[model samples]
Target chain A: MTPASSAKAPFQNKLLPLMLLLPQLLITLVFFYWPSVQAVQQSLYIEDPFGLSSEFAGLANFTALFKDARYVDAFLRSLFFSAAVAGISLSLSLLLAVCADRVVRGATAYKTLLLLPYAIAPALAGITWMFVVHPSIGIVGRAFIAMGIEWNYLLNGNQAMGLVIFAAAWKQISYNFIFFLAGLQSIPQSLMEAAAIDGAGPAKRFRDIVFPLLSPTAFFLLVVNIVYAFFETFGVIHAVTSGGPSKSTEILVYKVYSDGVVGLDIGGSAAQSVILMVIVIALTFVQFRYVERKVHY
Target chain B: MRSFIAALSLGTVLSVSALAAPVEIQWWHAMTGANNDRVNQIVEAFNASQADYKVVATFKSTDYTELMNQTIAAYRAGTAPHITQIFEVGTATMMSAKGAVKPVFELMAEAGEKFDPKSFLPAITGYYSTADGKMLSMPFNSSTAIFYYNKDVFAKAGLDPEKAPKTWPEAFDAAKKIRASGHPCGLTTAWVTWTQMENFSAWHNIPYGTKSNGFGGFDTEFKFNNPTVIKHFETLNDLQKDGTFKYGGRTTQPEGLFVSGECAMIATSSGFLGNLMRNAKFNFATAMLPYYPDVAGAPQNSIIGGATLWVMGGKKADEYKGVAKFFTHLSKLDVQVTNHQQTGFLPVTIAAYEETKKSGFYEKNPGRETPILQLQNKAPTENSMGVRFGNLPKIRDLIMDEVEAAFAGKISVKQAMDNAVANGNEELRRFERTAKN
Candidate 1:
């Protein structure tokens, strides 16, 4: 294929080319880079909610955050939470996709049903699970009581964390499922048939042929799922446990929201936002550099 | 041609008069449901009573935290409403915003209204007042924590339905009886931080924090780990051990325990009365909050728990005048009484309370006078006035975290309170540093 840059005709008018790119560049600047720069600048100052007065505090906000035991706890908790959510969601979606892929009859119906959950809002998904597991009024809650087990997520920190993780993972499974199914379908059936002719069982055939071929899709999904768990699950946490029963479920993004928006600690929140942004960038960079090397494609 | 000229001149004169329309004032509030309806009723009545101003009330958000955040954002954007209803916990933040708010007392005086701060109940106004007894905000829907018990459950439990527990020990005994009577849950409380910590400290006439619970200044520190608080939590821990006190979720979630007939008693805000009356299938009654009975100077007045109306600054003088007139209209005895009766909020003015009593309203509703009597029972001491701090909402969250830990048996009661004090002090120091700027 010809290189696109060399194949394109030379622009007769430089201003026309510049004008063509203005809208998208302006959008990126205003919506992405400008706010990020402002957040960085705001991290260096302490200001009240009304912005009546502000003082340059240097790195005091970051230092204080590191000293805060709760903030550190939330940080570690978020790491575990994201890992669990990503692992569980990726595995469950892959399993479902494999099962659906083997079905020849009514596969469209099964795929359609599996993809429906992706359309649900995260907060609504959390609420749905919360009601089903509510200590007093939930169906599963009543079953637990009848079985003589003490089940109250409101006071149980572990249970609260588990419930939020489940809800968040449940919301993300459909997205991963769609991607995995598409990847599985795009793989050549001839490879699997050749492996079968070599006296390979289903598991061995999948491991030897299909799974290796799907590694690129899996790698892409890993980064997306980790980022999803880190940022997109705030609504689930907010609706389910509110980082409550003693802050067991409080994630980094929720902390940013509570401190900046609700508590009106503008500088502290802005500092938190900057730290989170850096963490995401580093995570993405590590994924692309290290994880991508394992992909055969 | 002369007749046509006369008609054109008359039309011009009519248009000029229409240009001088009534001044519109915006009121942003967090009230929902029936309380929101009452707000509309009051605004409509005031608008109908006068042609000089028209008040437009807007439901800004569903709850206090969201409302306060929205108001602050709007204030920074230079588009804040003329007046806004802020919860009691936000009092200190509003007061610290110098030049951002106009003192209600000064507004009334400047508007040539005959304003008497003393006409209002001191317990209510003292919460929203300065050291010099100047009212900062108009007390709109002041309420205090009170006891609510299911009368049918009490009767089934062989306890006197006419009398409620007046002390903590008595309440514990009643809870035991209720449990023995096969009730699913014996007792529960809502707003644990408020009803159990803040008001609990004040009802025993003990300090919740230094500097009169932060009303004095920003340098105040939390003092809720006192012996009385520890002892109270220990008793609650024991109650939890025997299943007499069910651990409800934080805030108003436990109110459902009582409403659903699972729990027999609840200690929550009097503001819950309207909901109980509307949704409860069983007969219920209100009573004064139970005290420890052993502490000296106990059973002091309970502090307010509802929101108040504060006039925002940077408005036209005519808008301030309109706010002052609206405040005057709200403070009238009939209006205050109607609000108190309809919404179960405390009547802010003494005259309104007396008028309510004389009108035989309390007599018609036997337990309706409990909140008013609780507020007026004793003059408020420094500790019992109210809590004020810039980061009170965040502090409350810190306390809730530790309290839930204690309830879950992950920590001892004393340890929980200590943790709350330490973490809350850190928050206060942060607020102090920020507020100084």
Candidate 2:
């Protein structure tokens, strides 16, 4: 290790990290955390859905939420969606990251091309897929019809679920790939050089040195991706299927929206939001407290 | 400190003078495209016709659903518009808000504007009228469901284009023949719940729900899962499976499919006539929605499906007066006739309809009078009064979800309707509990 570089690394960690993270932390508190607390408060009460004349009803809302089978079914569906999205996104992103790391030329262009889908908003992503998969209008549906294979997603529950998962995974893979690329680039090249000199193969280098160093980034991406699946991808669900074909795409956040915005049941909507927050916070806390320790970096 | 006092007094003087200026009534609505253009034209005409009041109309969003959401949010913030156009579905919600709304009768009386509820059409006006026959909100654009068919498709199918289907069996046969003629879309319906369940029951003289579809009280639960509704949903599901009927998703927007020449026949709001008249390239015809053959008085009256203008609270006396004056201007027979003729919405007033009739407008147009005739056929039954349930939007989504399940083959028609009824009852109970205190 270079003594001078080692000396500077501690200085960057001491006060610099906090300074760099301050703006983001403040923004998260204001925009995300505050509204979340309000959502919890609103949920534990009887109020107009439009946020007026709210009176406390204690745990009645929570009790009702538990009693409704729709809530339970929707919660389970959200778990499936989030888990499927996180697992698929991580696997695909790690594969892309590994492939890109092996390449010696045009890596910059490859990284940009791979991360492009992440730049599209979730709403637009849903619309883009809807165009390509719509039974009557979409190209894929047309091709299936031409083959005399009746492939209307509107009537097929399995196909609808598959399309939603695929679309969500496609959007998230780009983001995970970007983060993995950064983590891969940060690993010391000297370690890899030494590994090659020690008669270690590419697979051994990746397994021994590279993967261990990337664990922290992988953990971080897992938490972020799961949270994204829970909250951010709701726009996709709303745009494409609108929890359609018999509530097959009805996730937690979509139910919250449907209850609050469309159903005009503010209290019920708030209850759903509070439950969603708990699920997200529990998963996030688990990732940070338990999963973070496994990372070698 | 002396200069600050002088400046404060000066500002107070200027503000007082501004308050003494002509009243401006701000209206927020969800009219867009051609309807938006019509709204602007009407507001401009009203403003030009008056000098003491200025009416400012704003096109807030694309559809009534979104606009209502925003309006409710705005109302919560105490920054709501002087007038908000709430859709027919929102009527119960708006009315349930207690002191949030000002009855149109009171607004007119306070403003010294002449208002007579008897002048408006019985079917359209009764939707927003209070139990004692006072108008709660001014009916802006009223519409009822009607059957629309493609004449070209019917001719190609070797069916008589001159005669429209009068019974459900006939419609089913026509749909099959039309699909057999090579058109992918045979028969499709928009607002499947509203057209096929709610209005369908009303038109066929069948009970849609208990307590007169919630119009009698807030305690109504969904009972459309009964034999008639089950039979109807089963017929639709069968046709959907047989490739003769397409179930266009929620809301009355089948104009897209119809205009694109995809669907041969559709049942949607009479309000969509403007869009179809402007967009349809092929010949089209309109008829009263088909009824069941078993019911003795099957061809019952259809209910209205447009929006009404509710005067919100927390406004000044003069502003309310201005709102009332504007409402009076909007309710004039001539203005109602113009709005109906230009936008294809049903005239809110009997005089407006008679005036148009005497002017030979309906005679020249022919199908323009079908909605009025359908709405005026007989005394509206208990089912025809319209749905008015607290937390109706939730009940609506429950129905939509279960119905979509039925369409997707996940559940049978009977099962879906049963689920919808159970879920809707749960929501109603929840809403009833909330409304109690």
Give the number of the best model, judged by lDDT: 1
The lDDT for every candidate, in the order shown, is 0.90, 0.83
Interface RMSD of each: 1.2, 2.3
Provide the lDDT at A273 for model 1: 97
DockQ for each numbered candidate: 0.63, 0.49
Q: Could you tell me the TM-score of candidate 1?
A: 0.94
User: What is the Å distance of residue B227 in model 2 from its true position?
Assistant: 1.3
Q: Give per-residue lDDT, candidate 2, residue B60.
A: 90
Tens-place lDDT per residue, model 2, B248-315, is 67775455778788888899988777788878999999999999889878888888888999888778
TM-score of each: 0.94, 0.91
Model 2 alpha-carbon miss at residue B392, Å = 2.1
Q: Write down the TM-score for model 2.
A: 0.91
Candidate 1 collision pairs: none
Residue pairs with backbone atoms closer than 3 Å in model 2 (clashes): A49-A266
Fnat across every predicted model, in order: 0.67, 0.54
